[model samples]
Target chain A: DAGITQSPRHKVTETGTPVTLRCHQTENHRYMYWYRQDPGHGLRLIHYSYGVKDTDKGEVSDGYSVSRSKTEDFLLTLESATSSQTSVYFCAISGSGDGLGFGYTFGSGTRLTVV
Target chain B: AQSVAQPEDQVNVAEGNPLTVKCTYSVSGNPYLFWYVQYPNRGLQFLLKYITGDNLVKGSYGFEAEFNKSQTSFHLKKPSALVSDSALYFCAVREKDTGRRALTFGSGTRLQVQP
Candidate 1:
């Protein structure tokens, strides 16, 4: 409950369609991230942002993209939806990524399905 | 690269019993470890973290983790397990060696508390 929110708690989309998941944080945190959780696989990082307009890929970033045009919003986009891409996506925010002080606060999560 | 391992897929405990969720990590530098809990249809809640200082780190919801530098493990423990404590638990780590601040997560272990 660190003032984080993820939209479309549940969604179903067809293959090849584009989908976007939004993560909004009330707190003005400096770091935001997108992660996907699937069976047999722990939470894998999809992408992350350190600051406004700053973004980088995670290990599983192949099929996803992220944007941070504003400080409060981090968006994850699936350019062409695939069945394999269906999973529970989570958004996390942190005041400091250095881990010297604070840990990440996560949103409820968005459950996506690609048919 | 830093990595986390949660060997157990599921852990069952009786009410009022002590519970332990094991987590092992690998990192080049001093690791910054963390534990998070996810309830049904809810986001992940930060339980605790270990950056430095005493090996025994206490956190929210009566949870504590011991950072064993020798064994490279940070196991979460609770004196009493509650039915309400049933949920998915995750172990994560961030290494000072990597440029990216995103955490590497384990597969997750489900804690089932029986009444």
Candidate 2:
């Protein structure tokens, strides 16, 4: 968990504004992920990256997008913020290819509020 | 589709009493199960994981989970509960053969330890 860091620890923006949350890692893990934590949703995957410049959508990827230009950096962007998008965003990394399982180490999380 | 289910939305147990939080999964082939805990205003912390060679996996903070292959369940348990043990718990799963390493998390179960 210490190796992962998420930027914008707390943010408040008006609806329709664009916002981006950054996740940086020092572990050089090949698999990086972005998840949103909501009341009943637990942690839903918004997007994930398998490698540099290779990303895919998750179950709740409608209003979100991700980019992984480097192995250590994974960014999640909201094209236009909405009230429904206000939730705590978490970034996770997996090094299973390095010989562990699918268990991930998560960043502290970024709390976003849209008014 | 691979998914995890945490039947109880909230579980309350008295201090010093045994506690259990139920979780079940549906996935193809052998599954990798994981448990995570989230304290207030923080990201998730890895508790334990069930990869192989162990039906009962012990994790941090005196928490343990029983992996029942036949029942498709991995319920978290603690012999004696503490007030500080109250937190939001999550169960996640990923198929071993899936290329994507991101886990699918359940709705989550809140454990409330009463004094």
DockQ of each: 0.70, 0.80
- For each candidate, the alpha-carbon lDDT, in order, equals 0.91, 0.93
TM values, all candidates: 0.95, 0.97
Task: For candidate 2, list the clashing residue pairs, or say none.
Answer: none
- Report the lDDT tens digits of candidate 1 across residue range B36-111: 9988877787888998899999999999999999999999999999999999999999985566678999999999
What is candidate 1's CAPRI-style docking category based on DockQ? medium
Please provide, for model 2 over B1-115, each residue's C-alpha lDDT reduced to its tens digit, 9 standing for 90 to 100.
8999999999999999999999999998989999999999888988999999979999999999999999999999999999999999999999988786889999999999999
Task: List residue ranges in candidate 1 displaced over 4 A.
Answer: A97-100, B97-99
lDDT of prediction 2: 0.93
Error of 1 at A26 (Å): 1.8
Scored by DockQ, the top model is 2
Error of 1 at A89 (Å): 0.6
Per-candidate RMSD vs. true structure? 1.9, 1.3
Work out how many backbone clashes candidate 2 has: 0
* C-alpha lDDT of candidate 1 relative to the true structure: 0.91
